[model samples]
Target: MTSFFATRLAVFSTLLLGGLSTAWLQAGENPDPLGEKTGGSTTVYASGKNAFSFPLASLEDEERTRFVIGNSFFKRNWVEAPASTTARDGLGPHFIARACASCHSLDGRGAPPDWSRTLGPEPDATVALLLRLSVPGKPAAHEGVVPEPNYGDQLNNAAIAGVKPEGRVEITSQSIHGRFADGTPYTLQQPHYRIVDLGYGPMAPDVMISPRIAPQLAGVGLLEAITEADIEGNARAQAAAAGPVKGQVNHVWDAFAKAERVGRFGWKANVASLAHQTAGAFNGDMGITSSLFPQEGCTAVQIDCLAAPSGCPAKGKTDKAGKAPEIDDDTFGQVVFYQAALAPVARRQAKDPQVLRGQALFAQAQCIACHRPSYVTGEGPFPSLTSSKLSRQRIWPYTDLLLHDMGPALADGRPDFQANGQQWKTPPLWGVGLIESVNGHQRLLHDGRANGVLEAILWHGGEAKPAQQKVLKMSLAERQALIKFVESL
Candidate 1:
C-alpha cells in the first residue's frame, strides 16, 4: 500500500526535479489545471441547482437545436394509448413513471421514494427506485437474466386506467452505528425492501430481487468515448499487481452491435451503449416502445396489458415491416444525443487546503485503486452518430468502469451477466457532490441507501474494506478534509 507521506515525497521529488517552484506546491495550486475542467472543454462552470442540466459548450448551432428538442422529449410526460398527441402517446398498461425526467429529474441522481407516508395509500409506488425481478436459470439471449415468469424483468407499481398495477414496493431502514478514530460517531442507514398488494397472481417461488436507483446523466458521453483497449488495460494492470483490488470487465450481448461487447452503462454494466440504455428505459420504465424494443412489456397472463392499444396515428412514422414503435427513430435519436452531450459540472475549490489534504487522504486510503483519477477519451462506440466534442479529451470521472466484489452487505443477491451477486460496477463520481444541489437529495449507492459521503464510505466492504478501515482510523480533521475534498469535485 502507498503511504500518505510516501505519495507526498514522490510529488515533491517530481516537481523539484522538474525545476518547478516549491511555492506552487505550498500554495495548493493544482499542478494539472486540466483537473478543474472535469469534462475537458465540454465541462461547464455551474455550481447552482441547474449544474447537471447543461449541454456541451462545443455543440454547434444545429446540434444545440437538436439538444433543445431532445430536452423537450426527455421532460414531456407520456399519455395513455389513443391520445391526440401521437408523438408521445402509448404509456404503459403497467409502468413506474410517465416520463424519463420523472425518475431522473434535471438529469441528476434519483432519490428513493418517501417511505414514511403511510396514512391514506394501501401500498406506495416509488418514483425513482424500482425493483428488478428474475428466477434462477440461464439468461435469455441479449438480456442476461431470466425474467420472472409473471412480473417479467421489472416490477411496475403504476399502470394505466384499465390495467391493474403489478405491485408496490415498501422500504424500511435499520440504523447501523460506528465511530471514527477520534471517537466521532457516525450512523448509516441499511434499507430493507418488501413487495405488497400483488396485482398478478404471485411471483416465482424463488425469485431474485434487485433494487436499482436512476443515476445522474452528466458526462456519460465522455465515458462512452473511452476505448475498449483502455478499459481492458485497467483490468490487466490490476491483475498484474496481484493486489486485493481486482477489477473485472463486464462483457454483455449488445442488441445494436449484434455481438458481445464491453458493458458501459447500467448499475451492473448490463447495457452496452447509450442508445440501447435509452430504448430499454422507455420500454421497461414507461412501457413505451421503440424499434429496438418493439414488443410491449406484457407476460402471457397479462391479458389487459397484451390487448392495450399502442397509439401511432397516420401522421406518425411506420416501417415496411409492419412494426410500429410508439416512439419514432428521429425523436428517439434526439434523446440519445441529448443524453450523450450533457457535460459534467466543473470542480469547485480544487485548490483549497482542506480539500487538498482530503485528496491525499483519498489516495492514502487506496480509494484511487478502483476510482481511477483520469483518462484520455477515444472515439466512441457509435462514432458516426455521436458528436466530435466527445473524442480525444482528458477527463476525470473517478471510475474504472469495471465490476468489483462490493461484498454481501451492499449486494442485492442478484447476478447480472458477468457481475455476480456480490459485484457491482464502479459508478462515476464526477457530478456526485452536486447531486443535492440539482436533485435536492444526497442518496448514494445502487439502492440509494447512503445518506451522504461518509455513510457511503462506511457501507463499502470486500476489496474496499481496507480503504474503509483506513478511513475508520483517520482523525476527525482528516475525515472532514476527505469529505470536503470529495464535495469540491
Candidate 2:
C-alpha cells in the first residue's frame, strides 16, 4: 500500500510539471488577446464569479409583442405573401433568400461563399446576390453619384427569372498576408466583385465593389434603446481619450419620417430606423411593395419590365381602398418589431484563473477603449426595454456603434450614408462565440473574409492598427486567454 501511494504521488507530480511546461510553450506562439504586451503584468479575476446573465423577460405592450412576432416571422425561411396574392404568399419575384432568417439564421453571423460548403460550386451565384456599391469618381463626395436608381446597391440573385434579374453580380477573392509587430505572420481572405450581364450593357470597370455579410441580430433591441445623445457622448469621450481612435455617428435621411435623422442600421450606417430598413429590404431585396418604398424596381434598359407577365399590374387599376396598391405597412411593421426585440445571450463567467488574468490584460491593453463593455439604455414602449429597467442597467455588448476608418487593407472604396471608404460601424460582440453553431459557418468581418476571429483581428488596420500591433507582440498563452474570454462572451 505504501509503494502504491508513492507511485500515485509521483504520477501527479509529473502531470503538474507537464501542465506548466505546456503553458509556457503556449505563451510563445499565440496571438496576444489583450491586443498588446503591457510591460506590467497584472492578475485577472475569474469571470465565473462576475459573468453577465441573459434576461428572458417578457415584452408587455400589445403593440411591442405584435412587432416581435412580425420580426420573427421570417426568422424561419418563410416569406409572407403579398397582400394582393392570397394563393401564393412566400416566394419572391426578386429576392436573395425566402426570408431574413435564411441569411441571419438563429440571429447569428453570416459566412462568405469561400467559407460555405453547402453553397457548392455555384458560389458566384451567391456572390451576385451579395450587395455592391460605387461612387463613380475620386474623393467620393457626399453629393456624388447616387446609388443606381431602381437597381440600388444589391443585385437580386434569385428572381422570377423571366421578369428581370436586378442585374447579375460576380465575386472574386484575393489573399493577403501580413506580419504582426512581433514578426508573427497571418493571412486574410479578401473579396473583389464585379457586376456582369447588366441589362443596361457594361458598367465602368473601375466601379467599386463592396461585399457585405449579414451580421448577427442578437441584442439589437438594446442597441436601438441606446439614445442618440448617449452614442454621441461616447464618441466624444473616445475621441478625447484617444486622438486617432475617434468615432462618429452617421446621420442620414429617414424615409419613414421624411426627414433627416441619425443613422443606425446598415453596414455603412446608412438607414436611420428599423421601419425604413424593413421598407428598403422589401423594395430592394424582395421587389415587394411597402408604404415607405412604394414603387416597383424597374430598370429602364430592361425591356421585359415593359412586357407582359411583368409582376406590376396595369397603370390605372384602383384598389379596394380606391388608392394605388403597395405592400401593407402593418405587416412590415410587425417584422421590424421582431428584429428589435432579440435578447442577448448570457456571457461566460470569468471564474477561471487564466480567464481572469486575460480580462485584466484586455483592459490594460486598451481594447476596452473602443469595445466599450457597458451601456445604459433609455426607456421604451417594450416592457423588456423600458427606461426603468434600462436606466443604469449594466449590459455588456462590447461595441460603441460608431464609424471608424479601418485603412486601405479592409477598404471597399464605397461611401455609405456619411461614411467614406474604409469606414464601418463597430459590430457588437455578444453571441459571437455561437456564430458557428447557430449559422453553421465561422466567417467573420463585413465581407466574411476572415477564416476565423483571429484572422479578423489580424486584418484590422487604420483606427484599429494600434490594437492590431499590440496583439502581434503578445505571448501565445496570453493570446489564447484573450480568445477564451471572447468565446465566453
Candidate 3:
C-alpha cells in the first residue's frame, strides 16, 4: 500500500509540475490578453479602490423593479404576474423555450446534459440550447491557410414536425486521457455534436459544425461600456507586447445597420449590440417576429416547425382584418433592459489564507489577461448606466470582450461572420459562484460541456492553452487556492 501510494503521488507531481510550468511560461509573455492598460484612467468610485466602480445600490434596484401595474406590464421572472397569457403569448413557432428566465433561470448560468438521464428520450432537455452553424471552406485571414469543414453546428432534436424540423441535432462526447504537467493522468471530456436535421435535406457530408452554450447575463452593461477604441487599442498592444496571448475583434453583420460591424455579443462575438442580439434570440431561438427578423420560419421545409396546431399568423395579419398590436418591442426591450442592468453578485469574500494566496497566483499566472479584473462604463441613456453613475461604480466582470483562438480541440468548426471556428468571446466570470445555486447545475463554457469551473479551465487550449498548462503544474494547495479564488468570483 505504501509503495502504491508513493507511485501515485510521484505521477501526480509530474503532471502538476508540467502543467504549471507551461502556464508560467505563457504568463511571462503578454499578460494583458484583452490589451487593456491602466495609465490615465481616473478612479471611478471612492469606496471601490479598483479600476471599475460598482453601483451596488442601483444594480440591486434594477433587479427588483417591475413594469407598471397592469396586465401588459413587464416584470422579472422572480416577480409574480396575474395573467397566464402574458407568459404564454411569447412562445414560438420555433422557440427553444418560453421566457428568458427559462434558459438563464434566475438570470444565471445553465447546466450541461444530465448523464443520468442520457439513455432516456430527452437527451438534452434540461440543458441550455446550443446554436449551430455550417459553411463552405474558406481562406484564413491571419494564418493565410485554407479552412476546413468538420461536422455541423447544433442538433435540433426538438422541432415542430410539420415544418420538417430542420436537421436532427445530436451530441457525442468522448473521454480522452491527458497527463497534466504534474504527471497526473486525468480524463478530459471532449464533445462533438453531429447535425442530422437539415431543413433543405442532406447537407454536404463534410459540412462544419459548431456548438455554443448560452452564457450568463449579469454584468453585460459593464462590458458594453468599454470603449471600442479601448478594445482595439488593447488588441494592438497585446500583439506588440511580449506575450503568447493574442486576441482579435470579430466584425459581423449588424442587422440594425444593414452592414457589418464590430461584434460585441455572442460566444463568437458575432453580434454588434444587445438590442440586435435580443432580436436575434426572438427570431432564431423562438421563431418570433421582430423588426429585425421579419420573416416567419419556413415550416414546409421544417416539419417540426409546423407541428403546432395553429401556424403563426403573418407578421402584420390578424384573424379579424384590423391592425394587430405591434410586435412587443418594448416588452422585449424591457427584458434586455433588465438583463443589461442585472447587477453582478459580490465576489466571494473568503478569509482563508490559502484562497488569498491563490488570488495572487491567479494574477501571476495571467488568468486575468482574458478575464480582466474591472472596467468603467461610459455614459448611456439609462440613469443607472449613465456616465455619472458609471464613473462612481467599480465592477469586476473578468473578461476582455474580445475573441481568441481556443485551439482545434475545442473548435466547433463553424464560422460566424468574421469569427473562425476556434474563436470565442471572453465570458465574464462575476456571479459565477452562485450559478449552481440559481440554476441547479454547474455546466460551464459556451456550450455547457465542462462539469465544473476546474474542468472549464482544464479544457482551455489555443490562446489559453498556456494558462491551462500552468494550472496543471501547481501544487495541490495552490490549485485549491486558484479554485477558491474562482469560486469567489
Candidate 4:
C-alpha cells in the first residue's frame, strides 16, 4: 500500500508539471488534488500541436479501435445522391460543408470565412461559419423558434452539384475601439450581414439571424456525462450566490428520447443529447437524413432543392429503401462514439506564478460564477456519453452547461427553446489553449468575431456585464494573467 501510494503521488506530481495550467512548473510535491488527469484517467498529454485530435488515454484497446473507425466517418466527405457510392451519397440538396470535418476542421473550433479579412473579391465567402434563421412563430409546434419562410432554419450557403445554392452569406462591418484601464487600446469589429443571390426567393421580412462557428469536440462526451441534476445544482448555487448571473436550463427536443430534455450542447443549449445533436448536424449541416431527422432541411420554396436527386428523402422513399435515411444507426453511432471518445487534452504551466495569479484574477472577476471550474460526472450508462475513466472523476471543463444572458454585444436576437436572444450557453474551455496549433487560429466566441481570448472576454455583457466591467478595470498584468490561466485550462 505504501509503494502504491508513493507511485500514485509520483504520477500525480508529473501531471502538475504538464497537465494543470499554462506555465505550471514542476512542484516540489503533488499539488493537484485530482492529479493530472483532467478528464479523469482518460486525459491525453498533448500540446503545442495535434492536441485536440487524440483519443482518451484510458480508453481500452477495443474502444480506441472503435474511435478510429468513427473518426473515418467523421472526416469522410459525402457526395450527391443517386451516385455510385450509396453509403456516402445523399449530400445536401442544400447544405453547408461536404463533410463534418470541413466545418469542424480537425475536430476543433471553426472561424468565420477566412477570406473575410482578405483583399480578395466576394470577401463574404463562408466556410465553417453557419447562419441560423428564424421568425416570430414556432413552425414545429413544439419548437419555440420558427424557421424563415423560404430558407428554412439554417441558410445553406452551398448545395450539391446541379442544384442552385440557397444563397451566399454577405457581411458588412464596422470597428469599435476601447482603452484598457492602463490606457492600452483594442478594437472590436462588429459585423452586419445580408443574404445575397437568393435561390429560393427572399426570406421572411421578419427573419431573425444567428451566426455560429463550430466549436471544438474534445471532452464533449465528458460534458454530456455530467448529470442533469448536477447541472441544475450548479444553476441553483449560482442563483443563490452573490452574483448577478443566473443561468437557466434550456429544454430542447430530444429526438432520441422523443421528448424534451434539458439542453447542454450548442451555443444556445438548443440540443438535448449528443445523439440528437449529431443527427441534427447530419441533416441541417449536410442534408443527410438519419433516423432521428428523416426530412431534408429544404423549405417548400426551395423547389429545386426538393426536386433534386436525393437517395434519402424526408420520408422513407427510394428504390433502395435501405439507403433512404442516408446515415444508418450503426454509422452515426460510430461517429458519435468518436466524438465522445476524443480525450481531454492536458494543460500547461499550472504551477507558474503568473498563471496562478491569473487563475485567482479569473475567480475574482466572477467569471467562475458562470464558467464553473470543475465537475465530477455521474457513473453508468456510458455509451455515447462517458467512458469508465471519464465517469465520476473530478474534471476541470470550465462550464456550467446552462444558459445565461450574454448581453446585446453577443446576442443573436434569436430564441432557441428557452434560450432568449441575449442568452448563450457556457462553452467548455478544455483544448482552448491549443486552438492555434490545431486550427491555425485563435478566434473565439459564437461568431468567431473576437480576435483572441482577451477580445472574447471584453465582449462579455448582460449577466456577464459585471465580470466584463471588472476585467475592464483590471490592470494589464491581471488581464494577461486571466487570459493565460484560461488558455492553460
Best by lDDT: 1
lDDT of 4 by residue, 115-201 (tens): 343211111222478889999875575575888888888888777767777777777678889998889898998877777778877
lDDT minimum window of 10 residues, candidate 1: 117-126
Q: Give the alpha-carbon lDDT of every model.
A: 0.81, 0.58, 0.55, 0.77
RMSD from true fold, candidate 1: 4.7
Can you write out model 1's per-residue Cα lDDT over 1-489, one digit (the tens) per residue? 235544563554332212223544575645453267887778899976788889887778888888899999999999998888878998987788889998888888888866552211222322478889998899877778999999999888888888888887778878888888788898887777888888879888999999888999999988988888877888887888756999999999877677888987999998878888999999998999888888889999999899888867323556676548888888888899889889888999876777667777787788878887777678754453354688866678888889999988998888889888999999988888899888888999998888889888899998899999999999888999889878887
Q: What would the per-residue lDDT of candidate 2 be over residues 313-335, giving only the tens digit for each residue? A: 22444456554323455556567
User: Highest TM-score: which candidate?
Assistant: 1
- For each candidate, give its TM-score against the true structure: 0.91, 0.77, 0.74, 0.89
Pairs that collide in candidate 4 are 21-348, 21-350, 22-348, 22-349, 23-349, 24-349, 24-350, 24-351, 295-314
Name the lDDT value of residue 486 in candidate 4: 83
Error of 4 at 144 (Å): 3.8
TM-score rank order? 1, 4, 2, 3
User: CA RMSD for every model?
Assistant: 4.7, 11.0, 9.8, 6.3
Query: Model 1 segments beyond 4 Å from truth?
Result: 1-34, 115-126, 313-321, 382-387
Cα lDDT for residue 393, model 3? 39
lDDT of 3 by residue, 1-489 (tens): 444433433443322221233453465633221112211121122112121212223433443453121112222221111124443343444445444544555456656564322211222434665556455655444211122222123334433334334445555778888776667677767766555535556655565656666677656655666666656755775687677778888776676667656678888887876767777765555555566666444434444444443322335445364323224545555655655554455544444455456566776677867776654445543443445433423445667778898888778766676777788888877666667766666788887878777888888989898888789888777788788778766
Residue 296 of model 4 has an lDDT of 84
